[model samples]
Target chain A: MRPDWIAVDWGTSRLRAWAMGAEGVLAEAQSAEGMARLDEGGFEIALLRLIWPWLDEGQAVPVVICGMAGARRGWHEAPYRMLPCAPVDPQSLVPVAAEDARISVRIVPGLAQSRPADVMRGEETQIAGALAVLGDFDGVICLPGTHSKWVQVSASEVVSFRSFLTGELFALLSEQSVLRQGLVGEGWDADVFLAAVSDGMSHPQKLGSKLFALRAEGLLQDLPPASARARLSGLLIGLELVGARSYWLGQPVVLVADEGLAERYAAALAAQGVQARLLPARACTLGGLAAAIGQLTTAVSGTGRKA
Target chain B: MRPDWIAVDWGTSRLRAWAMGAEGVLAEAQSAEGMARLDEGGFEIALLRLIWPWLDEGQAVPVVICGMAGARRGWHEAPYRMLPCAPVDPQSLVPVAAEDARISVRIVPGLAQSRPADVMRGEETQIAGALAVLGDFDGVICLPGTHSKWVQVSASEVVSFRSFLTGELFALLSEQSVLRQGLVGEGWDADVFLAAVSDGMSHPQKLGSKLFALRAEGLLQDLPPASARARLSGLLIGLELVGARSYWLGQPVVLVADEGLAERYAAALAAQGVQARLLPARACTLGGLAAAIGQLTTAVSGTGRKA
Candidate 1:
């Protein structure tokens, strides 16, 4: 089957590419050479290494890339499109001229807000994909990962959004901070997590003190590792929820994440008496990239315009 | 000059020792071998390495140690004393048996609070030292460091206290987070810092968003390094102040730190309309240990009890 184009999520640590035909995914490939590890002129080679088997001798393959590849220090700087705009705009695509004609690459621009001063690169792609799942949806879409983003989508456009350092904070606390002593476990305590969410929402100011308490609790009372880990995670996530109440309160929420992470968010929201629907994992980023490509294809095929 | 006893401040990263006599004239020494580095049976050797010159052969000299040396994993497991107690109890000192008969060692116990589940190892000494300067200060004492502590002292007893990770957060965010890009300076911005402090105190939940803004503001608006650094510090400290409102709302605040750090806290508190008086650096730690020793001296000399 002849492929139309490849959708790529090129993040900081890794890259995943899917060769999509007119029907569906023809082939999928990935690589460890993410944007962070590759230097100037390395991106083209890295992309080719993974998808070389899928390319033809003379044909050009459209590869739409999102995430860190669009960062200033990445392959090419795709300037951010400010918020209160369409999640994916055809005008925002930044083209990267590939040395090999077999690779035609374009990177999607990220989103930025001015007043609160927040930015999102890859998560915006997921936001675009979100619109595909729920056409004309008006609500909050939360994409949780290393950097969790709570986006407000209304009328097929992102009115505003906030990025929380919750995931990073949880990772840092569990691995690097004093809390590491008692947080080495895969087990979790749901009760502790829910209670923690209540505490965090009620007394947002007690966050710093609560963080230290995890370590103290472990030391003074020999808190179980599972409880310690769960408490630490719940505390941070709860802190984020308290901060992001404006985004989800009385608003429909659509969580976009893998099953585990999304369920975590759903449970957290449930604890707060809020119902949040979940979108299939990786649907948003892929759908978002595909949606963006659809616009380019339309512009290119219907009229002579930049794709 | 020969000293009466040696007062040592041993912490996670370094060790500082002072040879104290009845009079003021004495000697001081320091070493990089803090409690964190040494393994089992390494504490005695590390101590002697720094303070060996002060010892008289075969004559046992009383040595008082404070800080992390009393941590459960430190030189010896010096149990933490529960709060609503004296800063340092004579009975709470854990005696460390030294191979060298010339070195008679006593380690001070740290303070712990139960309700909020918090603990402090070294700051209690600083609290005691504060009492030395401001006799019977019935107010709050702010000890700003890696883990800043806001203590409530009344009638010469530590009634209650709270620990804030403000200093640690500043170090991590400035050196490890994305904000580090715009925080490589020794500059200060009074207005920006004051505004950020106000925001932090007024809306503590905005911490997650405000943190991301440091990086975004740098990328979009070309924010200055000094202002970025100042804003980050001010925000964390302000959030802590917000949580610790019960300690310093209308009560007096005594800032105990080195001139520069103390001045930072003083400035931050002044922005909140709270006047914080500054104390000489390290005086509290030394005085707190001295005060505790006075209790032992009175017990041994007057009551013929454990010295």
Candidate 2:
């Protein structure tokens, strides 16, 4: 099951790779050795460890990489392409000098916007994939994760975008802060979540004061761990929605995330009378990588590979 | 000089004690063995480690304790006294069983409000001390720390209060989050702090989005560590002020905090045309302890000790 090319998504905490042939994926591999764990020299070593079995005897396999692996401190610096431009450009792919003779690697540049000053790495590829699948996306695309991003698209180009630390805040507060004492289980309550979301959205200014309520309720009324966790999540997402109201208000919204997160976001939006289109994150990643591969095939004459 | 009794301010991180004579505090000592570090049996050992030298051969020394020392998990559970009541009542003090005959420890009961579900441990003593010295205070008293509290007072009773996790949020975001990469030093920019305060108060809803700007500015424009720290503090404090506007807007505010935190809160309030009267935190703690001591002296036939 040897492959002609490879698709890699190297992020902060984990790495995922796919071996590609003319038709579709032949094999897939992943590792916990993401960009954060790798130094400048560690990237090639980590990549070779996963894809060594797929390499041909003497042929160089073209590898298209996306995400933090292209960061300044990753395998090689792939400077971000300024936004108000297409999501991915094959001409801007930066090549890495790998010690292995069978490896030929090129990284997709991330997107950067000035003025308010923001940047995105792997999401650009995902957006490109979404555009590819949807034909042409005209509204906002939301990629929810540790750092959730809301992007505006027009005419196959990313117009503007904003990133929120809502997920990170929720994680820190629920796991590390005083609130951690109350949020202890995997139990969840949708009713409590929706109530908290409404509270957070309507009175965003009271966030600081409201956080302590979880702890107080646990001590006074014996609030359950699941309810506390749900409330904490709802509060942060609700606050995020208030900040991103301009992006989704009166506009078509699409969420690129897994089932659980997608359902939570969809329900939150539904409360405000907004319906969002859902796309699986893994599909979008592959689609984006395939779109970039199409651009690479167009540039190189004898590759004989279809994207 | 031999002391008549002892005063204790035992909190989560540190424990402070004063050897009090009939006139005033003769000598003071502190230790890192706070309630968090000490188990049920460890509190007596920690307290004795600091005050052993002051104990006489046979006389039982009256020790008045405030703060987390009176918590349910502390050495002895001095249950919270419901609000609309006086801050300190020596008659309500819960006595602890100490192995040593020379020690007679009684913990001051903390304050609790039912409607909004709020609780205060050490701050009640501080309010008691502030009221003892001020004769009578009718406005709000702001005590800033890990959990900053805004207490409304009427006549000599605590009317109502609210607590904000602003200080805790600032610590977590500046030291543990991704923004920590940009905040490293103790150098603060007052102008930058003020501007961020304005931004936070004006658009409290955008807090989740605004936090990422500190990191973005650092990556794109080389924002200094001090400025990042200042901005983070200002933003959290500004948001707190918004939630607590009903307590401070057009109302007199008395801040019971150390010089550094008091100055920051005062500056933030000044930006909103509110001038807060500052009182040293230690003084308030001592004052509250002294007020409780007076009640103790009146209730018991004194060994010639005056509060």
Candidate 3:
């Protein structure tokens, strides 16, 4: 189906797009041609290949893109917008010079913090989308993924945020480190996970020793692969939760993630007496792009300011 | 010079051999033919390739071996000896069926703990060496390497010990993880490292976020590669020191490592008001093997028992 505008979430490893009309998304498309797989000259070709069917013969359809596509190494650098600001500002939209006039592309700028030195790309768009759907969120927004972000929002502005390498560390250790042998195959024990979470939270400093314990347990007591994998995940996530304690403690938490990961997070948080409202990641991404588009339209009409 | 016996330190990634006379080492050789690169049958070949020159035509020289050569996946399963025992025991040594009648090889069994589920193959040999050199010592021994170990020794016996993935984590994060880009080049900042060590000790739970800060700082503040690498090293070591606090606090610490790594650990401990004496790792391995040989000799004469 033909659309008025397009929503593109271009991350490091994957690319997703949605065909948008006056009412809502009319069609969806995706590809593995993410920012990491493309060079400066390859972005236009990749985008054209994906959304060519949806573009009109003469009209230049506005393509709103978010995530790593705006990174310094992406299509074109969209400099990070310092935090204590709106997630997506219409004035900060970086327009691209597409070879094909049928598609006009603009990228969303990521948010950066100075003190603790933190940054986010596509997650900012998700934050904007989540805020749009939630209406007024003045607490914490937790986006769990490879590089998890815990954003503190106040009056529709992102006050501050911290990024944790929990998911990334888990993958590296379980797949590439010495722990790989014992962590092969996947069967999960929920009880083992929760216990490990408690251990991780209580003794986070002993992470190195705790990690080595998985292999030691496997060798000494014949700990199952599934249990070891579960323990590994719990230890990393438990440490992440400890790091993000300041962000979520005494604050309403909204988790932006999919079903499986969100459920694990919810369980981890629930054990700590915090109830998190789960929101699907895809909806938030689409919503964020829609919000950015609305602001862009308003600014072009001479009604909206920079923010 | 002809050797009375041979001492071999066969670890996961490297193999070192010393031709030992009555007084000390006569000639030494090393190769990358570690346990990881050799199977059961291959170990004999690798060992012979390194120390064949030290062997004579008829006499079968006693060859004492330590480290991963005794591991389950190593040359032959020497089987881990349960802890609350001496680092290396004479009776527990597993004699290997070497093809060369010129040399009689025996692998030193590693140590294992049940409750914490920790295991060590080579470090136990180092501890034996350290103890042999510093007689009547009852304190903590810290052996820092790929898997850094902290051992509590009492009356010449290993009461208990723990192994941390500190060195391995440092290698993985600095060389393979996302932080690799920011840590490419050989440079170091001692002050930056000390400060990171302090931070790691105080907030070891915040490791995930602190690690991400290295990348963020590089992007936003142009943090030098040298400083980033130093910071990464400090952070991991600092976390390790914190985890091994119970082993070192109010106890004498003997660090079995080479100069550079030992100095870092010493400085890290000094910051926490603990004084650690540095000992050369090679000397420890040789001494440990020598001690094992002495015990075996004494036992053969029916003077010394199993220990």
Candidate 4:
């Protein structure tokens, strides 16, 4: 009997589910009632609702979950795997038996950094996807988002990665700080932002001292808020550039992000004389999940489990 | 009749009061509560407690207040004065006639920047003191504190000034941000801080970019938190230096601050190629109050009022 699969990526604010057939083609896709909306008990009910339309007559399909859903506070704790592991490593997948016999669930484990006490729940999949796409290129891959990840990939394995809390800083500065008061009704200016980006990359050492000049210059000579916001964005991105540069020396960088963010990264990278390419994040995530599932299937089959 | 005099400097955090005799010599000094501790009814009661000791000694003193007490939400709404007005300008002083008895009160007005909608409540006194000391000079005077001020003085008058929220930013970043997680202790390295300060001033444009680098560099390479704090301090102070330079133009600067802040400014100024003299804040405040009082007394006497 061929097994039907449901793939779910549950994140901080949203939940996305995809139904895949044996051939790994997207049969049906549904997203609803975000992760934020579901409680522990509600997870099963929500999952059922999402995959209900994909279920054939008298057939109960198994589901695989990744991202924050497998977190300790999620539906079930998917124990994290330490470094020196591949995306296709079967040892990293945690099979969780659901209370109901009709439903089978498997969760992908997160990655942990012991020294800093930091962990990433969902980005491991993206890293896996990047590794799968690169096929054993040793270089740096930056996944930019709310919490940016700079992962070092070697021999198709994620050696290690560090997360920078850049987005949170931007949010706090733009929304909470005194800069926010001055930034009311401001919009993004690409020119100003890029200029700041170049300036930041050129002088990574003086970052702290330069921030106060924003308010002082603005008040004294009436600097536009848009420029201030752009300058702020440039500053954060520039700092990230310096940190990322330290890990991977003079090598090509692959940035995995959406179009807007990719553009920003491209500009920042160009400023630092580094070659960078934008990789589609969604495509990489899907590819990563497929690779993980393929590995799990092979492992189970080798163990003489029914296919 | 010889008029009993009261001097008050109501700053952002504290309210200090000094009772003066008929000859304008400080007879006794007292402090009750802080500006932050008072609400509506709290101010009057707090002020009475501060002056009650001197009042109990048979003194019917008329009080004069400067700083935040003159703000709209402060003790009473003392209206703002435009630029080029002395601190003791009789037309600028907001006098509040007591509802009962011979007790009278006067509040110094704050300055406002029309474009940025920013206002300074207390730095005017420091500017006044700097002017009283320097007599006549065209240069920038930096009053460093929680809300650091960079004022432009031209010919014994404050042309314009900008308030940089540098101290507040440092406090928030060090205490609230992810950088806080790394900061285990708090003894600053002046060398590290000065290096960062120099780096910041040289590349004032890159202020925003270097902040996130702190977390990334610290995490990936284990950069010390104390260094991070110093880096942040340097960034803010450097930015202030850049903004101040536009008004500074290599002119001799009077840095009015406490000892620690004075050191920081002295180092930052040295990097920026400016000669700065550290003026004790207490002395400056007292000198400014005295100058203001002298002007007010002369104005009242010129109007044929009994001394």
Tens-digit lDDT string for candidate 2 (A1-307)? 7787899999988999999888888999999999879999899999999998898777788899999999877889999888798888877889988899898899998988887888889999999888888886799999988789999999889999998988889878977898897898777899999988888999999999889988888877888998988888899999999999999999999999989889999999999999999998888888888888787777676654322
Clashing pairs in 1: A129-A288, B129-B284
* Winner by DockQ: 2
Scored by lDDT, the top model is 3
TM-score of each: 0.93, 0.94, 0.95, 0.65
**Backbone clash count for every predicted candidate, in the order shown:** 2, 1, 1, 11
Ranking by TM-score: 3, 2, 1, 4
lDDT of 4 at B67: 85
**Using TM-score as the measure, which candidate wins?**
3
- lDDT tens per residue, model 4, B1-307: 3336777888756888776665655554556466766775667777776666566334445677788777655778876666655544644678775543435777767776554344566677767777778786678788887677777777676777666667877777777775676566767877878888877767654443355567555654677877877888887787666656665566778899989889988888876677787788866766676666677777777762221
Residue A28's lDDT within candidate 2 is: 94
> Is model 1 an incorrect, acceptable, medium or high docking prediction?
medium
| Model 4 regions lying over 4 Å from their true place | A1-125, A129-166, A174-176, A179-307, B1-4, B20-42, B56-60, B97-103, B113-118, B203-209, B216-225, B303-307
Off by over 4 Å in 2: A52-57, A302-307, B301-307
Better of 1 and 2 by lDDT: 2
Looking at model 3, how many pairs of residues clash? 1
Q: Taking the tens digit of each residue's C-alpha lDDT, what string does model 3 give over A1-307?
A: 6798999999888899999999998988899998878899998899888888898787788999999988888999999999799999987899988889888899999999999899999999999999998888899999998899999999999999999998889888987888999989867899989888888899899899999998899889999998998899899999999989999999999999988789889999999999999999999999999999999999889998656
Model 3 CA lDDT for position A66: 97
